[model samples]
Target: MKLVAKREGLLMMGFKGFTHFILVTDSQEAMMMLKSEMDWRSNVGNFVEDVRLLIIERTVTDVVFQPRSGNGIAHTLAQFGLMEGTHFFWEDVAPPWL
Candidate 1:
């Protein structure tokens, strides 16, 4: 959410009363975290609580899981991130290799 806020030029105040979020991940555990409540005593409970708060606060609407085979482009991007130690911001056109 912090990365998204930076990308979208949003401040903490901007989250108030905001809606319309779609989260896509390849991890089943991440999907489950979004779908169910987590035990407060668990090691990653704080992170889970934060995500749940976003949902309860109406900042996020949906979460989807994409299989590795179904998300080749994303897989490639992940590799790029690892290789270059950088992140990308797409606007008008993507890199030629992509």
Candidate 2:
């Protein structure tokens, strides 16, 4: 949850709001955690419907995928965040040590 927050913060630093976002994860809990913090009334709805509508509206689509070995960066960053017990925003580049 904290890692997602940090990622969102990083995105906000680049632009106030993204036109589109897609999140995929193995854990429903992670998805729920993120949606819980969102503007439920305006932005979120039935997940599939929202995604389809966004596509129809010509909004950009940002996808988040959780595929064990495939999602190295997110996994690495998330693990790092958990280990450090700190939230850090990453921009164009990941942290040097990472």
Candidate 3:
């Protein structure tokens, strides 16, 4: 959604010198929603070119695929977001399995 994008953009701006930001997604719909908004010559061009631009700017952000089991933390974060979506800043809250 636009809200997630805005939050990501803001987070990217706030970070001191993070070289990369990865967005892990399990759902096709969520991936499509994100891919659609990525800037490219065409509306739907797989977003590689746009991603390359970000890398050139010294910030490498990309959407990555992960199996449901492998993406537990992201899933948990989304669930937490649903309950407390307005919290923009997160601290070091380790997961149970950690």
Candidate 4:
């Protein structure tokens, strides 16, 4: 699900003409999988593949790990996304809420 979200978010960013992003996640494993080479045989490989394909077109400048315990803002934003079905891209400066 994380990979799927990352892929979809990146796709939207590309459509909006953004070329770079900093990916934040609670799963270190997912970050590593995305940064390393594609593992075609793994069960989650397809999801990673989708994200990787998008990365090829854009750029992932960094990957930060934000643990859930210290991630109240992310949690809130996620809930907002779920309820509103909206995608936001904040660049050059932090989001107003942040």
Top lDDT prediction, candidate number: 4
- Each model's backbone clash number: 0, 1, 0, 0
Q: Clash pairs of candidate 2?
A: 22-62
Candidate of highest TM-score: 4
TM-score of 3: 0.48
Supply candidate 2's per-residue lDDT for 48: 37
Displacement of the residue 28 alpha carbon in candidate 4, Å: 1.0
Over 4 Å off, model 3: 2-16, 29-58, 95-98
TM accuracy, model 4: 0.70
Residue-wise C-alpha lDDT for candidate 2, range 1-98, written one tens digit per residue: 53344344434533654454454564555445444535445323344344333433434354354655776776787788779987667657869987
Clash count for candidate 1 is 0
Worst-scoring 10-residue span by lDDT in model 2? 42-51
| Rank list by TM-score | 4, 1, 3, 2
Q: How well does candidate 1 score on lDDT at residue 56? A: 53
lDDT of 2: 0.52
Residue 44 lDDT in model 2?
36
lDDT of 1 at 78: 67
Taking the tens digit of each residue's C-alpha lDDT, what string does model 4 give over 1-98? 67877887888888888887787887888888888875767768988888888887888787678797888877676666677787765557766766
For model 3, how does the per-residue alpha-carbon lDDT over 1-98 read when each residue is reduced to its tens digit? 42353345435644656555665567565456455545545543334444334444644476555676887766676667567765443556664544
Clashes of 3: 0
Error of 1 at 16 (Å): 15
